[model samples]
Target chain A: MSETPTPDGSPSTWSEDRLHRWLAEQSWPATLAGSRGHDAAVLETFAGRPVLCTDQCIEGVHFELGAGGRAAGRKAVLRTLSDLAATAAVPFAVTLGVMAPRSIEGVPLEAWLRAAITGAHDAATEHGAELVAGDLAMVEGPIALAVTALGHTSSGTVPVGRDRAQPGQLVLLSGPVGGSLPSDRHLEPLPRIEAGVAIAAAGATAMMDVSDGLAWDLYRLARASGVTVRLETERIQPHPDAEDAAASSGRTPLDHGLHDGEDHELIATIAAEDWAAFRREGAASGWHVIGTVEAMDRSAGHLQLRSPEGHSAWLPGAGRGWDYGGGE
Target chain B: MSETPTPDGSPSTWSEDRLHRWLAEQSWPATLAGSRGHDAAVLETFAGRPVLCTDQCIEGVHFELGAGGRAAGRKAVLRTLSDLAATAAVPFAVTLGVMAPRSIEGVPLEAWLRAAITGAHDAATEHGAELVAGDLAMVEGPIALAVTALGHTSSGTVPVGRDRAQPGQLVLLSGPVGGSLPSDRHLEPLPRIEAGVAIAAAGATAMMDVSDGLAWDLYRLARASGVTVRLETERIQPHPDAEDAAASSGRTPLDHGLHDGEDHELIATIAAEDWAAFRREGAASGWHVIGTVEAMDRSAGHLQLRSPEGHSAWLPGAGRGWDYGGGE
Candidate 1:
């Protein structure tokens, strides 16, 4: 019996061996082989010394489909790397679950997947890690990629967390604190791994990657650490590029620096005594200290923003951040 | 700022913690701990060996939106466990990536997530595994869960893939084979883990889960192994309940036996001499011998069905396993 016809019955139109041949032609680095592209990888030690994190990059929420394949791929890997950076964990390996639209087919689909994986692999390689096990499936509509990365922090690594800061510690911002929107800074966040590693190695008190904006994320840190945070508006460092976008958009760059998420830089606190040496050690590589941590009423888990005149800018507010708590 | 109201949100809506608490309240045995509820569990070995498999279950493709919280959760974990069963890998621990729609507020969403986690925990516990790491995200739409489970077969544990069968080998069915419509068997198809472990231990030559129906998947195995497979029409065992459904649908139960996917049972080949012992070992437990491997020929990659009257059943050939290979 004849099988379903392909209109003209052209055997030349389809080649199942395409994917295999393409994969074979590509050269892969030796270091990445053990943990990347294989069905499974054996980890030497994942029990007590591992660092694990999960991040979701949704279709419209985390990224725009219009970003095209290359950027989509880049964004997918960066989102997860940003998480790893938050913990000051060195890169290791990652697993991804990708969902694509039903309308995608043939070369375009393969190319998209290849680009995403390659982008991730290249980035991981740059970070001294690899891309490992991943799952691919077709879905009905928008594209979504879920990534999980596992890493190991060498012994004595300070586990960077929002809750590790102590009262009376000096609040610090690692670098220029803006450039989150219009600049596409949110789409392509630098994981700040180097800064994190340096700080942790130098005995930093507590740390976290600035994702949900400096103002808001700092609030989370202060709340978790049971401290009241005071911010000097004049000293807040806004990314120079953010100011350009803000000028054109009729908004203040400080607003962008304070409210925009995805900066992916480190926001940390160190004991006031350690601040000078810490800032000196960090500044050799361009890290900066933006402010100080002062004693506030314990009952006030509040974030007070001060203008140049030392006047309060607002009342207790949930500073601008990405609200993933769903609808009202 | 006030959040916009959605139908799924109200004062009585669910909270995340409460939902997690409810998930902990499921009725499950203690041995299921490694499998049930953790971010991700680490298993030492599966049946004394190492094996790894991951399954991602999306909302629309894997389960209906109306499927109760508990059922949805159970199905998600089962889907992953089933994959492990197919590979004959003893399940160890599971890492979950759960994406929930944000529209529904409060308890229902929490309840659903909790239920899903619990279901996964139940399956893990049943399979003697642990839940260790998890990634959670709020998405724009329907809920989906991805479970990545790790199992350790003994160091010597090698997957009995379908392509390794040889001529003269006995083709065996692990249990009653059929009734794979999504409505009935999709949610609760038995994972042939026990059968898989037993078959592997008994020295199976090649194996695979009987998804995408017997005839279609058999074709794939034959192609992979470079062998011709012959199936006895009279000998092919139909599911016990296939006849009733076939009657109602005005189709033959044999059709159901040959076409329905999602059974998640193991279909494997055993050496000729080991056939009798294998059958004897599983007979009380429901394994059956359905066919034999034949010499490779021009049509070696095809599945030839020998009807009772020595005729061929060329009616619409059964076998496109569900390929949800697009975006959503």
Candidate 2:
């Protein structure tokens, strides 16, 4: 049989044997015990700091390859970093589990992969993180990238989960809400580390990144806090881009603004009286308040939103939540 | 437009989104999160402690759907846990990364997935490990599984690597040598953890698992240690299964034993004086001595072998290695 072309396009000798030989020649980065030849590699922590988070971004659902490799890489970092941000964690390192197509042969694949890695590096450096271990394999269809980010949080900055929200607290959002849609916004949502850390530092009772839309995420905050939430829909700030898209599409700007997810902004709550001080602290670091928490029947996990027209748009389905099938 | 039909021939709402939602509802067995969603996990030491290793086995490369889900699941876990055996690392915990096709709607797919997890659990438990975290996703094509295993070894046991061999150490092979063709053996090669751990504890100088075949893997051991290695062809041991296949196919048994990769057995070396002790220790563990480690010129990465008929078998291109795209 004729030999298949290699990545370099010469008569390839990458038979199973040749692949082993090639792997043997690579000088692995650090003090890994046996380099890449062993079944599993053992990595040493340089500073006794360990960070780990795994994120899965699917194809068609996450992005199309035509969207450009850099954005895909950036999104990959953001998805993991957002999780880190939710916990007030700082990025330190990352490992990638990339599933690329087997048929997309040659330099293009390598080049694309390099671009993705470069994007990750850029974002990692911005967050003070670095890429460490990586696993690459070729599969049959659309590309998928799974990243595990390692980070460190300063002592005592524990996870400020929604459970910490107290009754009669004021709920706030960072910056404008809802714009990511029909394009790279969903593909490259920003990780709100600065806002999250600031909010935590300012003594916010509870926090979470707004992954789903505002209505749905507020429900999460309500369910976690065992109280009902009251929102002034008229005060619900909208991103200018989202406003333009809704007006042009003949859809309610409120609908698009409140339901259009992928806004990686922080949604936090503080004691009602603490709002001014929190706002002052947040303003110096960049933040905006949107609503407040109230006393509703603890048994009723409901969220109340008053529309601009003095009507209630309290959507029970508003916070459908990012339901992973079967509900783990 | 009509929705896609399920495997059961019903209209399906089994969209990727819906499947993700469904998966999220399934309660997972509680698992210890050593790193609990961090960037990397840490362990105190490696001396005599078990290390776990697992890799995802997707449908196309590892098996086909027609191959039967029961066997496929078993094969997936076996492939991963076998690596632990090679390192003499006792098996402990494993996490699953599954990508299921959305078209295979209904309980059948769920059954297949659960079966695979059950198979993994059984094999792991049999080998002294437990199944831990599992992640599931619905995609557009062939199913893929990523199994990550965690293991710990007993105190005082050292991790035997390819680079730790000393000159004059007798090389040994455990059980069968090769013949895990692209068939059943490939799907079900036995892992040699017991033998590996036993040999290490008995003072085997260096060792490695033979997944890529005797000749190619030995070359790796030699290159890593910066030493030259020469093999005795006649001393090569063949698995009985390979010997039987060779007899019927009119191919030399030696070729199958030395070249065909996927024999997940231990290939180790013990210092000459420790040879008796090694054999005695490995006797209860079931290993066979194969050759010797020698001090020779570095550039002569030659493997010498004498045929059963007292003729040379190391002729150019006579012995084969795995075709890892010809990098060997």
Candidate 3:
């Protein structure tokens, strides 16, 4: 047996044990053990239900080396953490699977692996989660990373799903959206974990993270909940960078707000009667009311945008955005 | 904004939704939901410690497409499930992250994805685990699959770890090991979950799955447990295919048994006093005593093989086997 050639035509010399030891040295939660040097990791789950999610970050797909390995690693973990936030679950532990190329940007594969692990560790620690276990493989392919986030429901709470919205519920966004790519917000945006828990506690109905643009994700929510979501165009607030992006790209800020993906913000639907209390508590967190749920009308489309002048238009391809095969 | 070209110089046309619908149609446990089109999957833990592990199957590194996508998929899940067996943890659910190439074996990307998902579902369901959540990404690289297996301890049972072995304990194997690669046994070996639980219940001190050859994996167990393991060469039983492999390759069956990786068999250390009882109950399941653990001697090797003629030799490069970068 000999060393395999990497995609960049370099020899792969990193051993699996070398990578395992690097991961074991990182700070992990006390509840995580039996992972390093063992077959699997053991973790203690709280008395509530468990929430699990997995997301992948592929080079030249989710990111390129030009953005740095740290950003790619952080985005991998953040994507899964965003799902935990949408479910209103408390973070527990994460296991990473990395398929590394031989070399990245003139740096050895070891450096790239270290940077990625460090970024994942920092992000997990910041979110009260632990990096418990990981596996690494070198291949003659683009670098790819997979993060599996495990979480649990807190006491007296239940995980929120995307199919629980009811008619007459108001749709809300945790913060501004759009222009995420230009601002690098997709890699650094905060997961609304606390806000998600607060909303779930105050009786929010359906909820999800807006990773694939507001128009696409909202339509998914509407379809899952069997309801129609009508957005008030005048009430939408674009991210601060949206105007600059729109000016340079010949598109309106509203267009970017509706089409730009990877915002990593939480969105939920709250009953009209519960909106007052939710708003009173969530105002400091930048929760904004943007739309309302109504009875489904197949002719009107699942998602519709209405202007202040009383003109309504269907959002074309409302549930389509940023697919991996169809690159962004 | 357009479909990207795959590594094999073909266009990727598989959509995330198309793969999701295919997975959702598979037979899964009743408890798995909110996974097909949701951000995260929610599962109920059975009031026990949770076991988590992630393993990767990269195309070219783990298996080439020449082996077929179904074999690749089955191997991916089986690898993680083998870890679960080593821990004696009852499996609950599995989440698959697939990064697909444009095409495989002259088939469309969608066909490759469907075959892989179907194979994963079949293997997981056969082992009494649900295929709960999955993420699909089409990348300009070789196919990569990551299987994150989540399991839980049954009531009154605890997860077995590699650090619990003690000096004077006997080492045992679940079945013969050798010539796995040539026989294609590496891709389809049975994971010894029931046998592992039995051994644990009968008081196994330490345990691990023998994936990277008996010599390498035994050394790992010894190092983790702070002991030295000695094996009897005359007592070692090679698999039925090992003789043919050795005859064709001009090596001894013992050589193959010592170095051939990916056996997927369970190896455990048990107290000498408990061995009799374990053997009485586990013999029907093919458990065989193979060696003994002793105090570590830095001057000597962690693993030593002794022949009946009073000759001994240290296994060369113990714990170094089948690294992805090194190429097996």
lDDT of 1 by residue, B1-328 (tens): 3544335553233333334334445553243212223222212222343334555677776787677666676766676676667556666666677777654643456556666777776767777765655666666556778776665454455556666778898788877666666346677766777887677667776777776677767776776677877877677777866676687877688877877777777778888667677656654265667788888756434467777677342212333333332111
Off by over 4 Å in 3: A1-13, A26-29, A33-35, A155-158, A280-284, A309-320, B1-12, B24-29, B33-36, B281-284, B309-320
Better of 2 and 3 by lDDT: 3
Provide a comma-separated list of chain B TM-scores, one per candidate: 0.81, 0.80, 0.90
Task: Give each candidate's fraction of reference contacts reproduced.
Answer: 0.11, 0.21, 0.63
TM-score of each: 0.76, 0.74, 0.92
Give the number of the best model, judged by DockQ. Answer: 3
Residue range A204-223, candidate 1, lDDT tens digits: 66677777678867776665
Give the per-residue lDDT digits (tens) of candidate 3, residues B149-243: 98876656656788777889888888888999898877786878888878888888689998888887887787777778888777778988788
What lDDT, from 0 to 1, does candidate 2 have?
Answer: 0.62
